[model samples]
Target: MQITVNAQPHEITSNTLDAALIELGFASPAVATAVNGAFVARGKRAETPLAEGDRLEVLAPMQGG
Candidate 1:
C-alpha cells in the first residue's frame, strides 16, 4: 500500500498503526500518532487501519519546554 508521511510518499505494507510504527522504525508507541489530519489516540493505534493516500504523522517527546 502507499501512504504519505509528513507529505512525502512511501510504499508500506502495514495494515495497522502499530505495524506502521514498526515498519517506520519507531521503537515504541509511547509517542503520538496522527492520521490524515486527525489525532489518533494511543489505545486506538491497534484498531486504526491505514489506507492509501492516508497521512501518518508520528511524534515523540522532545527534551524542551
Candidate 2:
C-alpha cells in the first residue's frame, strides 16, 4: 500500500502500524507514532490499521541541555 511517512511517500506491505514500523526500519522503541494527526500508543500499534494515503509520523525524542 502507498502511505505518507514524515511527509514523504512510501510503499509498504504491512497492514498494521507495528508491522509497518518494522518494515520501515523503525525498530527502535524510542520513537513516538501518529497516524493521520492522531497519536497511537506503543501498545496499540499492533491493532492500529493503516490505509492508503494515510499520514504516519514517527518522532524520536531529543536530549537537550
lDDT of 2 by residue, 5-56 (tens): 9999999999999999999999999999999999999999999999999999
Give the runs in model 2 whose Cα sits over 4 Å from its true position.
Answer: none
- Runs in model 1 lying further than 4 Å from the true structure: none
Give model 2's TM-score versus the native structure.
Answer: 0.96
List, residue by residue over 1-65, the lDDT tens digit for candidate 1.
99988788889999998888889888676788899889999888889999988999888888976
What overall lDDT goes with each candidate model?
A: 0.88, 0.98
Q: How far is candidate 1 from the true structure (C-alpha RMSD, Å)?
A: 1.2
